[model samples]
Target: MKPTFIILSFFFFGMVLHLHAQSKVDSLTYYYGVVNQPKSNIQLAKAYNFFTKQKEQSIKRKDIEKAVFHLRLLASIEKKMGLLSDSEISSVEALRLLDGMTNPEMIKENRIGIYNHLGIVYRSLDNFSKALEFYSKSLELVEDEASKATLLNNIGNLYLDKNEYSRALVYFEEAYEKSPRLDLKMKARVLDNLGLAQAKLTLPGALSNLLEALSLRKTIDYIPGVITSYGHLSDYYLDKGDRETAQDYAQKALEQAKQLNNPQYLESTLATLVLLNGTPEVVQYKKLRDSLEKASVRAKDNFEYYRYQFSEQQRLFEESEFKRQKLFLTLILVILVFVAIYVVGRVKHNKEKLLKVYETETRISKKVHDEVANDMYQIMAKLQANNETEEVLDHLEAVYRKTRDISKEHSEIDVEGNFSETLMELLKGFNNDEVRVIVQSISKVDWRHFSNLQKTTIYRVLQELMVNMRKHSRASYVVLKFEQKGKSMAIQYTDNGVGTAIYKKGGLQNTENRMKSIKGSITFESNNDAGFKASIRI
Candidate 1:
C-alpha cells in the first residue's frame, strides 16, 4: 500500500507540473496575440519558464527533438529579453540535437531561424564578427527574395555599426528596391536605415528617404516606428544646428516614449531633449534619465544572473548525455574491427578518384556561381537603375551574354553518355581544398536499369544537397555512399559541419516533393558538432 501510494503521488505531481506548463503556455499565447506593444521582462520571463518546463518534460520522456524545440523557443525569448550569451548557448544546444537525426527538414527550419535570431543578438551585443557569420549563414538558407532583402538590410546594419556608410547605403538601397509593396514596414525600416547611412555621407536623398519613412509609419499607425523616425529627425536637425526644429521633434519623441513607458526609449528621449535645452524642464528630465538608467542597469543584471543559472543547468545535462553517447559508441566500435578495416580501404580508394574529379568540377562551379552569377546580378541592377534607353540596352546585352554562357556550360553535360559519371562530376563540384569528399558504390549501380526520369530526379536531389552543404556548412569532410537493394536504390551523404536546426519546407522540402513525385523518399540528420547527413531511397 505504501509503494502504491508513492507511485500515485508521483503521478499526481507530474499531472500538476503538466497543468502548470499548459497554463504558462496559454499566458504566453495571450500576451503574444492579445497585447499590443508588450515588452515587459515579466512577460518574457513567463515565456522562458514555459519553455524550460517543457524542455524538462521532454527530456524526461527521452524526446530530444521536442527538447530542441523548447530550447530554440527559450533562446528566442532570451534574445528578446537581451540575454545575449544565454541565447547563443541555447541556440547552440538546440542545434546539437540534430547530430544523429534522420529527418532534419524541421531541424533545418529551426536552425535557420535561430541563426538569424543569434545574428540579431550578437549585433545587439556589438559583436560584429559573430553577427556577420550568423547573418551570412542565414543568408545561405534564405530562398525568398524578400527574406534575402531583409538579410541584406541586416548585413547593411552591420556595416553601419562599423561606420562604413557608403557600403551600408548600397545594401540598404538594394534591400529597399527588392522588397515588395506589401512589405511596407520592412521597406520603411530599410529606408530609415538608408537615410541615416546617406546622412553620414552628406548625400542628397537623406531627407527624402527619412520623410518618406515617416509618412509610411504614420499610415501604418506604427507607434514605435513613429518614435524612431522622430528621433532620427531630431538628430538630423540637431546636426544641422537647427535648434528649434530639433527641440520640436525631440519633444514629440519624449511624449511618445513616456506614453509607451519604455525605459530605454524614455532615457534616449530625455537625453535628446537635454541636448537641445537650457530650460527648467531640462533639470527634471536629467533626474528622470539618471533614475531610469540606474533601474535599467539593475534589471539587466538580475536578468543576466537568471539566464546564467538556466543555461548552466542545461549545459551540465548536455555534457552528461555526450559522455554517455561517446562511451556507447566506443564499446560498439570495439566489436566491429574487421568490418571497419574493409570500409576504410574502400573509402581510401574512392577518395583518390574523387579528388581528381573534384578539382576540375570546382573550377567550373566557381565560374558559374562567382563570375557569371555576379556579372548577371550587376548587369540586372544597372538595367533597373539606368533611365537612358542606350544604357539599359547595354546592361541588357550583358545579362544576355551571361545567360548564354550558363546555357553553354549546361550543354556540356551529356545526359546520354553516362549518368553515373555525370552525377559523380556534379558531386565533385561541391568539394574544395578545405574539405575532403569521398563517394562509393557508384560503379556497383547499373545505370541502364533506371529510367531517364529516375536518373534526372537523383541528379537534381544530390545537386541540391551538395549546393546547400557548400553554402552553409563549413565542413571538413564529406562522404557519399550508394546501396542497391533489390529494385530500390539508397544514397546517403554525411558531412562534418555545423548541424542543422529544424528545417522549413525549403530546398529539402522541394527535394522531398520531387522524390515523392517519383515514389521515392528522403531524410536528413544533423547536429552542431557532428555535422549534417541526408538519405534518399528511390
Candidate 2:
C-alpha cells in the first residue's frame, strides 16, 4: 500500500483499458487480455516474451505506431515486475520512435504517456531527480483534465516520499480541484493522497478526506485502493498517537494484503503490523524485508546489464549508419569526377581533329597554287606566242587569277612570329578602290600570350569574315578594331554597307566553328537601317 505501488497499479490498469479500447485485431486483443490477467510468474514471463516478439516484428516491418505501442506495454510490464532498468530502457525506446513520427497529435499523446512511465520507473530506481525531470516533461505536454489530475497526484506522491508534506499538499489540492471531476477510482486515489499529505502536516480535514476515500474505494470494490486506504488510515491514526485504532486499521490492511497475494503489499503491511505488535512479528518482518532487499539487488544488477547492452548496441548502430552514408556520398563524388574527365577529353580530341583538317587544307592550297597555276601560266604564254585569239588569252588569264585568289584565302602564315604585322598585312590585302578598310589598336594586343592554335583560329575566322563582307555586304568602308580587356582580347568589326539580315551559313558558320574550336565566341548584328557589326571575345 505504498504510494509507488498505488501509482504503478493505476498505470497498469489504465494501460490495459487503453489497449482494449484501441485494439481491433483479435490476436492483439488476446495478448492484451493475457498480459492483464493476474497469473503466475510463468504466465507473466510468457506475456513478456509475446510483447517483446511483437515489438521486434513491428520494428522490422517499419510499423512505427505498433512498435511504439508494444514498447510502452513492455515498459509497463517490466515496471510491474520490478525490472526498473528494463522499464526505463523500454520507455526511452518508445520515445525515440515518437521523435520521428509526423503525426503531431499522436506524438504528443504518446510522449506524455512515455514520459510519465519513465518518471515512475526512475522513482522505483531511487533516481528521484530523474523522476521529477520526466514528470515535468509529461506535465508540459498533457492538456486533458484527467491526465492533469493523474500527473498532479503522482507528483504529490513523489514529494510525499521526499517528506515535503506542504509541497505534496499543494499538488494534491490542485489535482482535486481540476476541471472535469475524476472517476471513482481516480477520485479515491487523489483524496487518499491528499488526506495523507494533510495528515503529515497535521492540517485540518485530514480525517474526513481519508474516510471519504475509504468509502469511495469500498463502493467501487477496488481491492488495491481499499488496501491503500486502510494502510494510509493506519499511518494517520498512528501519527496522532491513537495506538488502538491504528492497530485495528493495520490488522485490516494485513488481511487485505494476504488475500491480494502481492509480496510488496504484504511486506509493507507486515512492517506496519510489526510496529503495533512488537517482538515475534518483528523477526518475521525482518526476514521478509531481507528477502525483498536481496531480490531488489538482483533486479538492480539485471537492470545495469540491460542498460549497458542497450547503450552498446545503440552506439554500434549509429556508427554503422554514419559509415554507410559517408561511403555512399564518396561513391557519388567519384562517379561525377570520372564523368567530367571523359567529357573534357572528348572535347579536346574533337578540337585537335578540326585543327588537323585546317592544316591539311592549307597544304592542298599551296600545292594547287604552285603546280596548277604555273601550268596555266605556261599555257597562256604559249597561246600568245602562237598568236591565238585575244578572247582565248583573256579567258585563260581569268582562270589564273581565280586560282591565285583561292591559294591566297587558305595560305599558311607565320602566326608564332610577328603575328601583329602578319595580321595587318592580311587586312591591307582587302583594300581596293571600291572599298576602304581601316584598322585600329592592332599593335596593342599581346600576341605572344596566345597559343599557335588560338592565333591560327583567330586569323582564319577573320579571313572568313572579310570574304563574307566582300561578297555580300558591298560596303564602301570597313573598320576592324582590336582591344585588350583583362586576360582576354576583343575585336569589333563594322562596315558601312547596305545592311542585310544576318544568317549563320557558308563562311559565317565556318567562322563561328573556328572560334568555338579555340574556346572563343562571336556575335553578328545587322539590319537594313544599320551597317553590319560583329563582336569577338576570347
Best by TM-score: 2
Which residues of candidate 2, in runs, are more than 4 Å off?
1-46, 279-538
- Tens digit of per-residue lDDT, candidate 1, span 297-384: 4445333323544777888989998999999888889757767888776656544444444445556756676777677777777766
Worst 10 residues of 2 by lDDT: 300-309
Q: Candidate 1, which segments miss by more than 4 Å at Cα?
A: 1-28, 34-39, 58-69, 277-538
TM-score of 1: 0.46
In model 2, pairs of residues that clash are none
Global lDDT for candidate 1? Answer: 0.76
| TM-score (all chains, Cα) for each model | 0.46, 0.51
Alpha-carbon error at 326 in model 2, in Å? 9.5
lDDT on C-alpha atoms for all candidate structures: 0.76, 0.84
- When summed lDDT is taken over every stretch of 10 residues in candidate 1, the lowest stretch is 297-306
